[model samples]
Target: MKIALIAHDKKKQDIVNFTIAYTEILKQHTLFATGTTGKRISDATGLEIHRFQSGPLGGDQQIGARIADNEMDLVIFFRDPLTAQPHEPDISALMRLSDVYQIPLVTNLGGAEVMIRALDAGFFDWRKLQD
Candidate 1:
């Protein structure tokens, strides 16, 4: 499965921690992430991730494109709700695309844990039927 790992500025460290904790499960699949977040995750966990531009610079849109093209399956985005993002519209669009395409999206650490567990259990095989 192709998984996207995204995190807002304040949540970047949290995502890196999550990646470190779940390295074994995560390293089993292809990973993609926005610039700084990707760098931090890769550096911390040594997982190979395809990195795109920074979120405010179109990274979200790039991942959204993969989602739209049926090239993406899961999205783990650690959003900082208290902070305001300059690229809010792009974030909204990316989320909307996830919904439109029926992709599994986890917006917080709790949800990401559940989704990652499900992934480990092979529950996402249902996604193949959608394709």
Candidate 2:
């Protein structure tokens, strides 16, 4: 499965820790992420990730494009709900596309843990049918 990883500035550490904990399962699939988040995850866990622009700069939209095209299967975005984001419109658009496309998205660690486990268990094989 192709997975997009994203996180807010304040939530980067949390996402990084989540990635580290699930490195074994995550390493089995292709990973994509926003700029700084990708760099940080790669640096910390040594997982290969295709890096897009920083989220505030356009990474969210880039991933949304993939969703629109039915090219991305999963999204793990660690949003920081406490803080206001400058690129709110883009974030909304990305999420909207996810729903429109019927792609699964996990906005927090708990959901991500469940999703990752399902991925390892071949529950996502249905994604291949869409392709």
Q: Quick one: best lDDT, which candidate?
A: 1
Return the TM-score for each candidate structure. Answer: 0.97, 0.95
How far residue 83's Cα lies from its native spot in candidate 1, in Å, is: 0.7
lDDT of 1 by residue, 25-101 (tens): 99999999999999999999999999999999999999999999999989999999999999999999999999999
- Whole-model lDDT per candidate: 0.96, 0.95
Compared with the true structure, model 1 gives a TM-score of: 0.97
- Distance from true position, residue 62, model 2, in Å? 0.3
**TM-score of predicted model 2?**
0.95
Residue 118's lDDT within candidate 1 is: 86
lDDT of 2 by residue, 12-125 (tens): 999999999999999998999999999999999999999999999999999999999988989999999999999999999999999999989999999998899888888867
Runs with alpha carbons beyond 4 Å of true place in candidate 2: 128-131
Please name the candidate that would achieve the greatest TM-score relative to the true structure: 1
